[model samples]
Target chain A: MNAANSGSDMPAWLVIERVVRSHWSLSARGERDAGAVLLALWADDRRDLGEGFLLRAAYLGASRLRVIELALDEAAPAFPSLVEIYPGAVRMECAVRDVLGVQADSADSRAWLRHAGWPVDYLPLRHDADRSARFAAQAEDYAFVRVEGDGVHEIAVGPVHAGTIEPGHFRFSVVGEKVLRLEQRLGYVHKGIEQRFSQMDLQQGQRLAARVSGDTAVAYSWAYCMALEQLCGTRVPARAQQLRAVLLERERIANHLGDLGALGNDAGFGFGLTQFSLLKERLLRANAEVYGARYPMDGIVPGGVATNLSSQQIERLREQGMVLEAAVVELRAIYDEHAGVQDRFVTTGRMSPELAQRLGVVGLAARASGSPRDLRSDLALAPYAGLGVQAAGSAQGDVAARVAVRFDEVIESLRLCDLLLQDLAGGAIHAELGAAAAQQLGIGLVEGWRGPVMIALEATVDGRIRRCHPHDPSWQNWPALEHAIIGNIVPDFPLINKSFNLSYSGQDL
Target chain B: MLDILKRIARTGIVSEPQLKLADLLSERDTLHAEIAGILGRALAIRQVDAGSCNGCELEINALNNPIYNIEGAGIRFVASPRHADLLLVTGPVAKNMEIALKRTYDATPEPKYVVAVGDCGCTGGIFGESYASCGRVSNVIPVDAEVSGCPPAPTAILRGILSALASPRR
Candidate 1:
């Protein structure tokens, strides 16, 4: 679709035009923003990677005809801080500063990178670090949002948690059971992933993307491969595309199963946990049997899938899927009918539809908040478009609504998986992706288990990746967590947080 | 009684021992083997997330599910300076997770072995390091054995653990 006429569905494009008023080459581009068209441009190179491009939208309130030069340099690019214009861009700009070495020349350039357990001298995204240099051990005082009141206390939870979960420090300023302010201190699990990419080949890099978050393997892998393919101008075989859809659907269902169970368990319903856990186990086992991996990683390569599913495997998948569906239906009825569970989840952690829209929360959480922005449908790509998939959403913006959205998505994914299997095409699984042409930039967007994952790939001469920026939905949604838990009780944080299970690692990257 | 029976029916059956002696004997043997496995060798495991997208962590938590029972294997994830005999970390360690990767390695107690479970942990199985990633676990952390597949079936993770325990580096 053409950029001007593409309506909300138009692909994001970067267009350079010369302003008649100024000699500078004005760079203007369109990005999909909450079902609307938003333009972002900047005049500096050093701030480009960190501020202009990194921050979703930075509005400069100067002359309308001011010439803007689009900066796409590997080392550094400059962009004006929109924190003054659009306060929402603050966290995003800070994130860019942490990973990418591009420092935001904004007013608030405090000790963002040196917080928690991150090494100070090293910037993970920069390519200058030596491979053998031992990461220096440094500990700096972490600054958290302070709150003072009568009978109010603060609880500092660990970067090393009680469970086997990743390290993230949660500081809650609370009065008895009511939480006044909750500030998150993450980066404890920060590994120099982006920096290490310079030292590895494309294949190795793809592995890292998939592991960004373990659950959303298909989404991250596909997003990475899509970026790679776009850079090299490779066409994935139709069969491979279909297989990818199947893998993605499988991942969606598996995650839903686990989430459903966990949500239930969180509300003191052990039966739901046991039943859903059992269902999840069966599904994972089937996944392992068919895809050789339970979570289905390495399934999507640059040009196509690394492996193919056989007829027998497909049949087995169908059978297991059917059984799981039946169990889900049965278990869901039990959950829906349970009064105590329903009461706990119904309106416990409510993020009003209006607030959700303003914050731009995506995935199931967004859907629950009445934002119907599904990349699969709204930004339809490949097999999903062909299949005529319908995106599901809710407007309640509550924990129960989130749970319901997940359930609806699980059912929809099951249907999609069945259709994909039935219409499985026979063809070569892969196409040879030749080296990327120099200075080629490609954008990849895929709906992950959590939400839409956006990846931008820039290649250098000889096909080496110059810069890659994979934006997880969590980047936008993590802040929403801070907002969602505002009025809720301190104990309900887990329930609310679980509803929108944003990945700290995914966001940090 | 009828209500209880009906509720039981809704869930599933409650299994009773068919042969108490045989059950006792099997349980004893299983316990004996588990203890023996723990005593036989000190296992060093390094977790590499080939690419898991963390759904596996839920199940990994369930490994200590108090039922399927992981600790009974005498397996524990260690975090400190050279105390970990096994390195059990997760993730396709994203680009940001790279330094943590080296630190995890540096902290491992000597003669440490690595077991990369989950697909992402193995070969950067899925989320190959994109612009946001360093790619695979092996890229940052030195790996000994790879438990391939996206979050290798917990059974696979178990098998990988067993294999790591069996093979000790001199």
Candidate 2:
């Protein structure tokens, strides 16, 4: 389709454009808006500018992305919350409120990311945020919205969960086994990662990014480095990009294997857990042997990847890939054929396509609900573009659909891994980055195992990071669980949750 | 069911033997007996993630895989701290999770052990002493043993648990 047809297809963007234009016309417009246009970002030496906070919102279309920026006056920082357009923005709006002290012009003004860790006035991301201040113990209990009525009881599930999982509290209002409402109290894992980013040099910041969510380490680090490289105008070698793809694809497979097993275990099938976990273990061992780190948290660096492979190493990986693909295919057939497992998974945690689009759920969860917009295919970047990565999709938006998408993606990723190994470009694995050019705003978006991991970097003229916002697609997904769990029994929550598998730290940051 | 049985038959048992000294650190068999003897049953561990990147938790979970078969070694991760003999904690204690972690610790019966898992748990790793962080796991609760790696591998984590159980409290 041409630009005109695509433009007409976008209702949300058209509405946002109209809203921005009206706001521009209502107020005394600045020189920035020639004809009520979307404000161009990183303009006019933003590095040296006064304390004006930037509000950035990215709308990813079928083949295009529109990033809208509104420069709010720092003194009275408030913007119209996108919660109306994207209900997922409510928690994020609260995060901005707690972290940067930015007010969202919305009714729901609950605190997020700040569990009374700091005083209200002491926003950690403010220009004058002090590093030495200490706060006393939090005195108040979070007032979760109570579900009122007779026979309606509440079950509080955790900040520290039952298993070896990340911490997040879930409040389930249920009458017997049927869930009435599910209110999630996340940000229990907030470690001041965004605040920590501001203190690092551009080169040192990627380490923190990698830790944003441990499972998606490769994606976060790559995105962070991608942004930094963009700012510094560094050229990553073709070999490095290919190695990065290998690591990225491996990370995806590892996570999928783990989750698939967990989903089975949650559904009461121990055999599924045993087989998938074994496969996952084998993959992790290969990672440790090849990359020198089981998780490879530091594998992807600023200009390129951390490690290079020899031709023999490439051949070894190729042989391993074939074995994994065959085993995964075998397992997929078993999952599809198992009547007991299929009965439990088929209709559990069903989120309608309408609800998914309305709530702005992205990534694999979005794909399960029929959108199927994978960044690898959507953005069509180097290795992914050439490898012809197929976007795995389904319309059921149930646990079964999510499982199918994962299985399909793993098969596709295995195929890509083989192709990537066959076509290795020989060169330096990393490039030394030069001084970052002043007044550049670097943005990097990579398709992580969970979803799209995005990093927005702003560095000082001297190369220290000024402000960085690392966003996880979990922010777009976690809320969907609340809706999906409404009709399901309390026992199925774990299966539904693992199917979505949204990262707690990704959003908690 | 038949396919599952066949797969299990093919996969056999990848879990380490009872006396795989080289697999774990020194004194693997003795530590296992000590743990099983101490509890007189399975050693129930309750894992508490204070504010980790969840990388450490990944390794902790890896201990459950058939290759590690942490359960076969007479240890199982229980849901409730009240039912636990040990607390496996990960991450630098986020200020928000401080009270929750503390509550979890208090809920566990006395003579309970807490093994700090991961570099973040031991020394706060990269996120040391931040405005929102309390640094190490010790900052929130008493830790008996420490596992220090970006995220200590499953074997290292298993070794840390053995050390924590075999040795006395700090």
Candidate 3:
């Protein structure tokens, strides 16, 4: 195995071979400290493609960021645990232990999360496990982070909440009204998405990705398609790329609008919710009229988009845009004038740039805190690159900053969508994706509405997916919630949480 | 106050006042029908999430949208085995959700009606079963009606619910 030294002196890409054996090759790329590691396992046979496993490890070294990749042999071998090396690996390791049934030789193996929810013997991701089985087994209790202090009362909230939202448990340790510490207990929304992917083909898989988080359908589907296209070596049509961008931006605008309203409502501004909801309703209706789906699922496919827009539709979009723009301008003025709304949002739930960096927060939360790391702008993918993407960010690192970032993003998205509509080119909506050639691995990074959505697709020679990992920005930002809630009054938790609006299903997946 | 005025000025001038009035009347009519339908029969709904991320639930809750109402449909999501007549579930049931799948099914009071809304819920439209799923709602649950599209438009969802109610229970 090739090992690279940590520090600024290190090269952008470190190629590691025979890390475990001849069967696996690991490539650690990007800057030495702030880089990602890609591990590709050589498939000796087509069956091995279905059987092989790829594991990703992300951590921050003393000076730089460290990411390691491990590819397991079909005959799973005992590998040394990286949990000792990077404490973050503990969660990932436990995940692997539960899903892949890989026995990790670690001291912290006190049922990390593998509650007896499933039959003790059945690993859902594995091929042989019979799905239709009896459910007499009881779920094992998850180990929550422990907290202790005088007057530090522990408040446990929801696997089931009062609102019509997904299930998640929040454990708050507060000294009277001030929050001392906040520990989130997720996985209530864990529906075994990764395991389900094994049962689907490329066409079916795209649909699944879109549903990974309903709101992020456009991002998840695009990321999934990117991975599939890479594996299949298919080039999407330029028009299709433009269409995808339009849909993605629409999704972004819709969500941000809704969030802005929801955050306002959470902070005791119902008028904001009403106005935003009306705007959102209008936007969603426009989407349905144009894309045939309000949320725009199945619109993005592997090679290209599933549908096309006509001149008439484009004209309708422009008309709708005029309406939305006016509404946004109106709302912006209201939000600006509302000192009461400003008071709650300005300094509450502040996360410093240093703290954001340490927690590895991505998307708007990170950007608001002065981390100008936008995948659309920095990565410069096709349609985004053409738009001359200008990222708007702030160092306030507070709820106001996050809201500002979202507002800016909404405006930027509207501009991009209009540009895309204006630059509508005539071409085929989609291309036929052929079978895979060799055992190949492909990575997909899309700027989802929430933030950067990363999807890694691995396939066998016969075009079957080996392992697909769709990483939502929520994974990185969820932890930041715990920190943001600190020092704030317990009542402000809802508003702070709403400002970020991280996904339970996204992170649990 | 200036901002409010600006908002009024900025609001879109869609010639929908007449359409809005018509829709309002129609919505009221639908509400009456829905209430009558609910009162006439205990409508059991099976919620099938073909494959949504669950945003539709927000709007679904809006069935109680306060204004564009649904309780008049006498619609209720039953949680217990005996009380549930309609199974209103969501998502293209993820692989992990399969067990919860059976539990949800077993928990539902039989002679239940199923309404699969959203494309994923209907046919595993987008999120076909992949490494993370079990495919469509029908794959696990016995779906009676399929509401198509990524997320069936809310109107589409209402239509599906109405249609499911129209159908005979098995």
Q: For each candidate, give its TM-score against the true structure.
A: 0.78, 0.93, 0.80
Ranking by DockQ: 2, 3, 1
lDDT of 1 by residue, A395-463 (tens): 999899999988888888998999999899898989998876544445566888788776555566755
User: Model 3 reaches what TM-score against the true structure?
Assistant: 0.80
Better-scoring candidate (DockQ), 1 or 2: 2
Cα misplacement distance, residue B131 of candidate 2 (Å): 1.9
TM-score of 2: 0.93
The CAPRI classification for model 2 reads as: high
Which candidate ranks first by TM-score, i.e. highest?
Answer: 2
Model 3 segments more than 4 A misplaced:
A1-32, A35-54, A57-68, A72-90, A103-114, A127-134, B5-52, B58-88, B92-149, B159-170
- Residue pairs that clash (backbone atoms under 3 angstroms), model 2: none
Query: Which of the two, 1 or 3, has more DockQ?
Result: 3
- Candidate 2 reaches a DockQ of 0.80
* Residue B84 accuracy (lDDT) in model 1: 59
Please count the clashing residue pairs in each candidate, in the order shown: 79, 0, 51
Model 3 chain A is weakest, by summed lDDT over 10 consecutive residues, at A37-46
Compared with the true structure, what per-residue lDDT tens digits does model 3 show for residues A1-509?
A: 44422322222222222245322222222322343211111111223446365444433222222334555556663345544333334455565666666655673564433445455556655656565543443544656667776767888875444355665668898889999888876654555666566556666788778777878888999989886776666878889999999999898998898888888888788778767877787787787788776667778988899889989999999888877887777687788779999999999999999777655567788889987767677766777777888787999999999888988888888888899999987889898887754445455667887777766666655556655666777766777888899999989998999899888777666
Q: What would the C-alpha RMSD of candidate 2 be, to one decimal place?
A: 5.1
Q: Of the candidates shown, which would achieve the greatest lDDT relative to the real structure? A: 2
Over 4 Å off, model 1: A1-69, A72-78, A84-87, A105-107, A113-121, B1-59, B62-152, B156-170
